[model samples]
Target: MPTLRRTHPADLPPVQRRELWAWAGYDFANSGYTTVVITAVFNAYFVRVVADGADWATFAWTLALSLSYLLVAVTAPALGAWADLRARKKFLLAITTAVCVAGTAALAACGPGSVALAIALVVVTNAAFGTGENVIAAFLPELASEDGMGRLSGYGWGFGYVGGLLILGVCLWWIMAGAAAFGVDASAVVPQTMLITAAAFLLAALPTLLVLRERARPQPARSGLWRTSFARLRQALLESEGLIDLRRFLLCIVCYQAGVMTVITIAAIFTEQALGFSTTESIVLIMVVNVTAAVGALVFGLVQDRLGHRPTLAITLVAWLAAIGLFWFAEDRRLVWVAANVAGLALGASQSAGRALVGYLCPARREAEVFGLWGLAVKLSSVIGPLAFGAVSWASGGDYRIAMLATSLFFVAGLAILATVDVPRGRAAARVADAAIG
Candidate 1:
């Protein structure tokens, strides 16, 4: 609902390159939680070991994961609103990072079938991760010049992918050795992984704190920031029709990203179930994908900058459709290997480009709030893909193929909506200020 004012790059307020990198730095740290703990190691542990003996236990854990994301989806927009009004982007990021770290560290205490503890820690950690990402997302425009936005975002994704891969590799080694040499319990492996992940988060966040500089502009000081944010959110919802570019973008994101989310959430499950890969094998496969995705992020980031965000996004959507089709038709072990490579290349590109596109459309003053709404789309999609997959799986007596096919529809639909979105006028924020004064 809010409109962005334009400015000139040369006249824009000063921001150092190190500061930009630092703003992007959190990705390096938080991604480990995503890669090593949540997606690769922890999720597998929960299904394979923690809930191994009980069907009901697995069901309950699944339900809890869904509910946790639902809570995040509900709260994220308002949190973003508060960030925008209060100008607490950095502070909010710190708080969310701490929450993620603390939650991850607590996983060290969880034993097999410690379902309640596992669920609680995961929920807190995931919510923190989601919220922190939104705060960091708002910092993008602050970090880079208008010309640099795409590249900087891409660099962040590339760095994040590398960071995640590094940690996943370390965890995988320990997991394999622990299981093989000592008859080690899965609980022991998980706790150590959690500690390492938590530590990485804290370490990764330091560069951002030390280097990223955000000169907060003045806003009318509101007595109730949260309440005001909620009111603004309501206004945004009501004015949705006028935000044609943003609205179209959101619709496309919902469809395309649902498929992307489905693939990300299910990659490990797919590899294990369909290809008969072991935990180590699956983790290795994911590591390969993520590491490659970092490279893809960097490449696409450059491409987006050169050609503009929308064209690059269309390229990614096409790649996604092809990837899904490839995955669907994959049969031989060799083909599965090829599919992993394809997924790795496009996964991070989609996210980096999507986030940059949002940055372009969002009003400067309301950047954080808009990013929060974006987060809601993403987290809600996380819930949808899993639930849809679960339902289809259940109906088909555990056949996952149909669910995957359904996911591809999202790509096609997303591509359609994305095609309709025209890029907003590219003008620096500082120029607008100078013009007003003149």
Candidate 2:
């Protein structure tokens, strides 16, 4: 059985190489859901076909996503606490994965004018996906030391994009190539698209379920789940008062991740509506972006470890601002392509850097609890960014360009907060917290 190296309290959890691969595999498994359902096919499909291009289509889509993120924000801390205290991260993760897979597959039953059905299913799938994202991430510290965290995160993210690209390729082939020959219209293949994502998610998730070990030792039950977890959360927050740098970092995450999440949720919608990209072209563009994002994840992961996490994240945020500027004024498809690739590069780097920074600052034996708070910050940003963008579009009669351009404010806000975070101090605080654990 795998065991932690306890020569020192500050030492990281011991992880087998294969187990690390299994851990990364969960990232791979879940990416297809995001790439297909949220980014490429389903969002646009819902906006255009399911809602019949109504003025509120965009708003409705965003609302579903916003509600899901809000649910995660509300529930993640409690879930994390429960999982950690019970050594049931795997069990909870499995439940979430099952919900996501089943919910995504159920989307196949949604068709034209099935807006309510589609929205409801999307909420279930996305909420499950978002919560599971945090649960899986709680294992990061067990797999790598501080120095290696960025690289490990980057590897997983890179592999995730590869999963996304693979699924997109399948989607493109089925929609543009195979379906036409089978006397099937593109719209008729929507069920096929949903099924593909669900199957892929189930298949890819198996490695993590089968091979990854649950390493946390169970603590005795303190009380009922809600009260106990909330009590733990309150205590963690009190202790975190001394870790001011970590507090600042969470604010940074909320601001920057807001912009990033906005782009992820709506880029395809923008291109299709503003740039007149057909579904095929949209898929192609996203596939290319996924490639660039993979490269950015790997390159920036290495750079952050050598150059310092704060600087790495700062560079990416600046790049995000620049990319958003280009996107704001992009009137031609070529220019949109340029803007998107730039955003893609920044997207991968910023996500990798931020996650690694959190892991670096997180206290030992409290991965689930602290990361739950991390999840709260991220999900709150998700709620704010997308809901704000959707509100703008809805208010302006679907003036999507104005809404798209407005996301830059989030990046600016994130940078302002990020500058205040002291990475070294946060790391030191975490170490002290770790050493104090008895």
Candidate 3:
């Protein structure tokens, strides 16, 4: 276990200082999965290479993700609860990351014929990666003061977008032109791609291990961790009338996140299958989206800090609706490129602001528990979103346009729900929760 080094609450004034950067460093670490593995490269590789000929591979992959997220939803709150009680955030984060990194690294054993093994590894990797994100979420309050949460969240999002973009660029170049540079045959490049990606995941984790300080002492016994976590989550959610606001937030997140996840998870498939782009072209398109997302994170982080989280998130919801509408009418690969960039912008804006808003709404003391619930919101949407996209596409005679159109409703409904919920009310309630807990 890493040593717990205490940071005084008085020392958190600089919104973008070293502590915050160390916090955001985790984003840079995890975005490799989102960019290179999930969005751009590995997903495409799976559908095109590993999962080919099993007409069921795409559906199976989606199902695997859905199952993984379902597990996350069930387990995250308890994990958060356990971490809080035990002061074991670092331990949990390290363990979960190791699972993900190991799974990602083991992808080297997957070849054209190892579909079952590939699926197992991906499932392990995805589950651990998703769960680890929740553990990382618990570390945020230690890194930033209350007032700085929005900008800090935005910075994390921005950093993640940039990191993912940079890594994806390298992976793409390696495929397109780096084979000769590395003295490797073009045929062996894909596995090498996985190897590089795996290395990135491990290296990215090192900063968090080295820099972020957790001052809390672990509970001696690790027994009943999951059960205790669930019990505490229930208590957190139902402990007081104050939780009603969090309920509203969770509901809104579910609807909007479903749309966001659908669009992002299905992007490469939409590009290649619908727009008739080749693998390399699809990857380049995904890269363009990520770059634009980095820009959007920067712009919106400032906007969120200025105009407030709800309005910024609402604007993102509107942008998401527009992006989906664009995709529905998308005629050529060019339009897909346009939609990808637009969606990227909205994706970054919403994620950055949404997380910040949750931080703002939850009391600092209860942050870990609340973040666990937030993780539940995130993972549950993972189940509904991608599965919905896949199911819609499957049912619509393979037309992805319907799936795109369907996502617009999610955005609109979520926006409406958010409009009714008062951000100030949530904040006030959270303060009460904090005082009571304190």
Best by TM-score: 2
Name the candidate that leads on lDDT: 2
The CA lDDT of each predicted structure is 0.77, 0.86, 0.78
Q: Which residue pairs in candidate 1 collide?
A: 7-428, 7-429, 7-430, 7-431, 7-432, 8-430, 8-431
User: Of 1 and 3, which scores higher on lDDT?
Assistant: 3
Ranking by TM-score: 2, 3, 1
In candidate 3, the residue pairs with backbone N, CA or C atoms under 3 Å apart (3 or more residues apart, or in different chains) clash, namely: 78-229
* Candidate 3 per-residue lDDT over residues 1-438, each given as its tens digit: 221222455644333356567788888888887677777777767766677646987887787778778888887887777777778788888898888888877887777767788777877788888888887777666665556666778788888888888788888778868677778755457776777777887898798777777755454444576666676677766765676777788889999999888877877787778878877787778777877887787789777767877899999999988888787777776777787788989988898888878877877555677888999998898889888887788799998888778778889989988987788888898888778756
lDDT tens string, model 2, 319-425?
A: 99899889788877788889999999998899888888988898877788888989999999998988888878778887888887788889899999988888888
In model 3, the Cα lDDT at residue 32 comes to 84
TM-score of each: 0.91, 0.94, 0.92
Candidates' RMSD to native: 4.0, 2.9, 4.1
lDDT of 1 at 6: 23
Cα miss at 372, model 1 (Å)?
Answer: 1.1
Q: What's the TM for model 2? A: 0.94
lDDT of 1: 0.77
lDDT of 1 by residue, 1-438 (tens): 111122335645667656666766778888999887667888777776667657665466557667777888899899888777777888888888888888898888877768888888888888888888878988876656565678888988999999999888888777667766778764466667878888888988888876765555535546576678888778665664445577578767877877787777667777787668977788888988987899889999888878889999888888887777787788777887787788788788989999888877766677777788888888887788777777777787877777777777878888888878877532333234224423
